[model samples]
Target: MGDLLTFKAGKVRYDETTKRATPLAGKGLVTVAHHEEDATFVSLVWERRGPGAVDSHDGSEETEREELLLFPGDAQWVHCKKCTTGRVFALKFKSSGDRLLFWLQEDNGQAEPGTLSAADNEISAVLNSLLNVLEENDGNDIVMEDKTGENTAALEDTLSTTNTGISIPILSITDALPISSFVAHIRSLPEQALKPYYDLMPETFEHTRENLIKVIQTPQFFSSVDTLSSVFRDSAGIGSLVASQLGYPYQGEGIEGFLNGARESGLRESENDRVAKDQEDVMEE
Candidate 1:
């Protein structure tokens, strides 16, 4: 075991073992342990269950109880065998060479940068597409971080407002969709219904309108939107059919609603305003 951290009563405390904190609070504990020199030949088996126990290469079920070493202030991402995906512990060695031991830290497990799940990827795409739509129309509008309930309605209201240089600070849309209503909507759907859209835009549910607006201002943004929309259109079937399958229910093509909303939101109108109409056509098909 490298190290463990526990939380108790809104406060974080450290300990070597559970016993040490038993007299007090065992909310969090970090254990530093390593195998002996003779056990160097032991195989490290990575498992999803429990602390990583040392095992013999001979396929022996017996787990070796390694000695816990003490040193240093704290451990960072020291590189372990199990730092593959998601949030992971950052570990460091207490000493080099024969004195090689390990320390572990509780991390969100994002060791690799730009790492995202399928859901995250799609949300980013939608946000990016919306950004392109916003940027094509020259204005001082900024994306806002809001989602659901009064906030969602507020966004609709703001988009419909007659203001110039409006900024929507949707810094929390993605994180906030887990409220009861949203969860209920998601749960009501068949797993397959959301797959196509999710596959196309893996991170849609995790986006903030603010970040979405920012990305569209990048170079050749319209082209990017066209490309993304084209893919959805060409793929057709479950691909372009995402409006009903994934997003909130609406009449006709939802792209029209988005365009009309964008227009009313006071963002600049595109020279080729037909782009929105074209996207609406894609959605209709």
Candidate 2:
């Protein structure tokens, strides 16, 4: 709720093919703010201008704007690109220290990564504070609500109305098997079968097979699977697969049936219009 944190702008080079960034020259102003209703989310805004362009200069207004929204446990490195100028900038957040890393790439394709330290004490302090808040609530649910009395709805009501379902067939299969049996079956699968999952995860695949099995066997993990399966069922495109595998194919009206129904309704409406016109002609006689 206090003053926003701002830092000087720096030169950034970005590679389209690799989606990486390298830091280049002078510093510019960057601003950071936390969402008023959601403490777990933060917003960062920055601008980059042509070389030697001052705030009061003619070309100063031509500065390119970039904005980013970050949540707890986001990936360490993120990049932003400017479509008009083809300029790319990258930021890497480190929780261990009071610094924000910047990167840009040179014309020759070498990456130059630079660190913005505590010399800008105000910005550094703000960044550190935001990181600390996120670390404190890393795996917890973040509920955003207005503190004022205007929002009186209960959390349950809000969740019920806003939640959408997307199903995961693999997770749903766990419902039919005993927990121990399910865990054993998953652990017995070939490493190749799990590679797709590990690749999708943000962290590197460093855990041993036994350790991974132990991690997934916990009640907390099962609860998360259930919640995710309930929230994302239809949107995940696994509903049909789930129904077919469970021996209960979906019988609801599909797109083709809905189109045929619409066609019949339109035909009836046209017939009624013709009958009304005939009645009007007879009345005129």
Candidate 3:
């Protein structure tokens, strides 16, 4: 485990029932919730020491000018509004660099000294929020991709194949059909398939297969689950990977959940092998 970074952000009051906090949010701040009850929170409050210009986020120059706020303070407690969870503590940093490197410990609730990893989520969320704030301040805006039409078309194709009176489920074919054959099957699919290839082109299979091979070739392929998890933790095109196999309509949350399951399975396998080896050694004695 690496060093766990800690920051102190004063005190906080969390309502066990309402699951929300006060003061901090009203002060032009945004809060992100963690799943664990005792998971530490991290925040990077910024204050500009000099002059800077806020511009339109549309990849253009010139808009507005203002001082930049960089750091806020230490860690503080916050809660989720949707659940009756316990109060969550947060750490604060001054610079974006510090916040990026600030790792948090994720508690599994029943275990002590919880899981520790570099605060990847905290950094991504905070930086994105800050950029959004700057964009708003400069009268710029966030861009949202509209793939609804494409997604719907893709979904229809998958359902037509799956919800049919077939001898086998479509998911079963996913394993038996070779990548080329599967793609060709979809391509020859009638309009009922609704152009599923557009959402994800047929060429995606080649790339995904190559990457999977890379993962298998890694020296730590049979190492700890943590090591293997790290390999696919931020998979280059994880969204595409899921959409290709799951038949379009891919969500990042879904991919992450699947990855977590795979990690747990790997860890259990490793432990079982270790125990078996120990028993074999004892028998030899």
Candidate 4:
């Protein structure tokens, strides 16, 4: 136990039924003295300065009185469970921080209810300090008790999976095409690659091209392009539309000839070079 800590009480009252001291009327001083053996028992004393003299008498002539509001080992130290009709006295020492009922009575009849409270920050600090000392002397580690009553085993299972890195994997759009390969392909395309399409729809192509350039300059554009390319590759109707727009027959012998021409072009070598460069850059990174 440490030295007694005192605080100025802003209000004091008295519970008629419980017959316990309460703060009401005007402010007063409160002091708390700790018990050496019993951690729960504490002594509380209150001192109230009387009103100043109104006559020619000096204000210093007014008498101040001290009251032993609570004593060591008082029954008020233990909360009453059944009482419901008296002033409620409470003190919280844990993170719960809720007021714990310290005094109560079965009934108050017609007696007006009363309350006592000290709002000074120093008072709260002293209370907390007292709790800390008691916990230390009792050789107990203070822990935050879980009040939610959740399943502990389920929580532990979730935490275990997180710690072991066994969570589900997330796939992004770039998984469809390597970003580096997509960037290289765009860079290799001729500036007039869309000329045929533009010739077919001049105004529409102009707007589309402008929008495409803006989108391609952004860092995430490669991933979006990869997703769109995947969709086009998987859709036969889209491929036919592309062939027809480029002035090549969409099917039959013309399709075979167009395929043959594409294979014979030097595109394969350029693609291989791009792949190799992408791999080299990845390794350097």
Candidate 5:
């Protein structure tokens, strides 16, 4: 619904399919948002301040002189290339004119927008490269967990199992092994534990079972799982969680270290607790 990634960048263009690029006159606010109706559609919107414009995008803002460029998130490459003048991102696509380019920078409290420090700029460059890996993907990454489709097919296969087969498919949400056994198993499970979905159903089972199946069957679910895992794996502070789980020495030291740990873990009480509680009688109102 909102911007997934955004930055200020000037639009660049190629001349007659040549490598040489011509940077547009002015830079603008570039916003990246997902397609509202489709999970797979990622797109970009660039709004540059200029002469009067025809319309706006995604329902926000009625304004004059707004130059806008939109690119549907289908691109062959979204990599940053260093040029003699400065860094320009080459957002290559099968079609032309979708290259969303930007001048990467940090904004000082009083300085102009996009005036980032060198360190921040370096980090931004690295992140754009990472985005390239995620957004540049063209493969069909959605795959159902098991080799089965449709719950009915699974149940039928289970019911038709024969004596020639040593074992039934044991039909998981993902399997099938028997006619009588499967029926008995269904009767046995007032609530199936790990059959269709491997989640430990909550007290809200009636509310969530169908929702869970719908989520699992979604076309982008599998690929999204992989992409999110990769992002979290490389995210800062995740290492701290992994270290804590594995019983390693605390990565941080002293008061600063103790306070900066993963907040998701139960809060630790110590001599250096940031805010100590008082007796009920003396507590502040």
Candidate 6:
């Protein structure tokens, strides 16, 4: 939908192993279809589950019919509708729209501008507050935009009560997601579970493994390790509590070894060198 390009609905040839899809132009009308809000309208990867128009890439005029996997394209959002009032579409769905709820509920995944993902569910408190306000004004029909008028002498009824039609890029074939590789990748795997993929797709396996190690070696990961190390090497703050939770059997305070022989190798390094030096000087004095 970027830069106003016309997209003809098309068929695609998909490669399962490599996860690549090559689209063929279908020369059909494309619509945004209005993604529903009350339910997960789409899946991360899906098929329409019926015979669909497929484009025949051959030079001759021809086509095929079959199902194919669908993925969202580069653009994050679009606005279009199936019904036509001289090709009219609503920008924002009505508060009382019939299809606000969706029939299908799938785990919609895409952390983009328009796609609904896990992030939406994270704001329960805000939703609860909105629900309370809506409950208080149950009978009040507050339109987001009001165009009703009894006196239409100055302006015609069409002009007075017309809903302002907004402009948005129409969803088209070019906006579909590319399938050359996996749409998402895993940062971690089950213990030794990647061995099979290691033998099969060595490049992919190594790529994933290397990235996972890289993430672990990051500064954030080191900070987490520092927090974990304190549970055994120090008993300040909640360190002793965490150690006790880990079955360290510590009493009162301190992270000294209990019944378990588990302990950090060599001497416990001083976290605050200045404080340690002060303590040493005081002991000598």
Q: Each candidate's lDDT (Cα)?
A: 0.28, 0.41, 0.30, 0.37, 0.38, 0.28
- Model 2 lDDT tens row, 100-138: 324222222323222222343334445656644322212
Lowest lDDT sum, 10 consecutive residues, model 5, at 149-158
- Candidate 4 Cα lDDT to native: 0.37
lDDT of 3 by residue, 170-205 (tens): 222122332333334544646544343343423322
Best by lDDT: 2
| Tens-digit lDDT track of model 5 for 158-179 | 1122458575421121122222
- Of models 3 and 5, which has the larger lDDT? 5
Error of 3 at 165 (Å): 46
lDDT (tens digit, per residue) of candidate 6 on 113-212: 2233353332222322322222121211111111111111111111112336865332221112111111223334554755544453323214354334
**lDDT (Cα, tens digit) per residue for candidate 4, span 1-285:** 664776543222222233333223333455677644344545455455455321211222212443222222112221111222223334422211112222222233434333222332234445545444321121111111121112111111110122376654223333333433344465566767745433543242233443343234333444455455555545556646665666544442223333433444446557888999999999999
Candidate 6 residue pairs that clash? 10-26, 72-177, 73-175, 73-176, 73-177
Candidates sorted by TM-score, best first: 2, 5, 4, 6, 1, 3
TM-scores of the models, in the order given: 0.17, 0.31, 0.16, 0.21, 0.30, 0.17
Error of 4 at 171 (Å): 65
TM-score of structure candidate 6: 0.17
Where in model 6 is the C-alpha error above 4 Å? 1-207, 231-240, 247-285
Clashing pairs in 4: 11-23, 12-23, 12-24, 13-22, 13-23, 13-24
**RMSD values, in order shown:** 22.5, 21.4, 23.2, 30.4, 23.9, 22.8
